[model samples]
Target: MGPLTPDNYELVLGLICFFLIFGVLGKVLLPRIERLLAEREDVIVGGAARAEAAQAEAQRVYEEYRAELAAARQEAAQIRQTATEQGAAFLAEVRAEGQQQRDELVAAVKVQLAADRVIAEAELREDVVQLAVELASRIVGEPLGDLPRTRAVADEFFERADQAAGEVQGSGAHA
Candidate 1:
């Protein structure tokens, strides 16, 4: 060539610059990029492992809560059964005691009725004897003035009284 052109010189310089820049970038920058990518991958893997461990711990706690709930239900059932038994026992005892009191009250009433009947009989006998004496004195018109006759009437009245008392006592015993 007689003289180098400006365009040809510029083209040659641009090619040399491009080769130098690519060579330096490949040697120095590419390894650093690779190391950064590896670090990012390690961080992602470690985070996934931690998340899995947390999920397992949560499941274990849930199982423990379920077991405790079952135990509580069983305990409540036992307590209810015991209370029911005790209530039944207490009711039976109260009923027995009430029956005993009623029986005692009935027996006392029967005894009091018997005692009142005996007292009434005694008083009736006394009144009958007095009326008989008064009627006999009026009929005789001597007021049972003679001692022997009076004594005989009195003895007859006493015998009749004894017979009536025996009959009443026999009837009461039968009843």
Candidate 2:
């Protein structure tokens, strides 16, 4: 062969060597690289799927938490309502009991006042009767020895005074 141009033998040998190296790269290295690329793709896709699944799981958990929270809040509200109702009922019972006690106290005071009025009226009548009897004995210049007759006269006077008071009260009401 010339210095720059290869002869026929050298060219044929170079062509055969080129074909052998190309065959090795295409048949061995190319398939191994394709397999590695396929495995990497599978891993990436699996990772994406796992991420989606994890997100779905997280969403489900959040929903469950929300539901539980709502239920708890409702339960708290119900408890508050029940307690408020019970408190109101208790207050009502206390008010009613207090009112009943007040009524009872008022009735007792009224009864006591009535009894005191009766006693005072009786004492006043007795005093008035005694005074009238003394005045009559003094005016006549003699003792009125008839005690039963004097008491009967006093009873009659008291009845007339009571009737007169009743008539006055009735007339005032009409006016």
Predicted structure with the largest lDDT when compared to the true one: 2
lDDT of 1 by residue, 59-168 (tens): 99999999999998999999999999999999999999999999999999999999998898768766765677678778877665445676576668778978999999
How does each model score on TM-score?
A: 0.54, 0.62
Give all candidate RMSDs, comma-separated.
Answer: 6.5, 5.0
Task: Please name the candidate that would achieve the greatest TM-score relative to the true structure.
Answer: 2
lDDT of 1: 0.82
* Each prediction's whole-model lDDT (CA): 0.82, 0.94
How would you encode candidate 2's per-residue C-alpha lDDT over 1-175 as one tens digit per residue?
A: 5699988898999999999999999999999999999999988998899999999999999999999999999999999999999999999999999999999999999999999999999998888887888999999988874766888888898999999999999999999
What TM-score does prediction 2 earn?
A: 0.62
Clashing pairs in 2: none
Question: Cα deviation in Å at residue 63, candidate 2?
Answer: 0.9
Candidate 2 worst ten-residue window by lDDT: 141-150
lDDT, model 2, position 92:
100
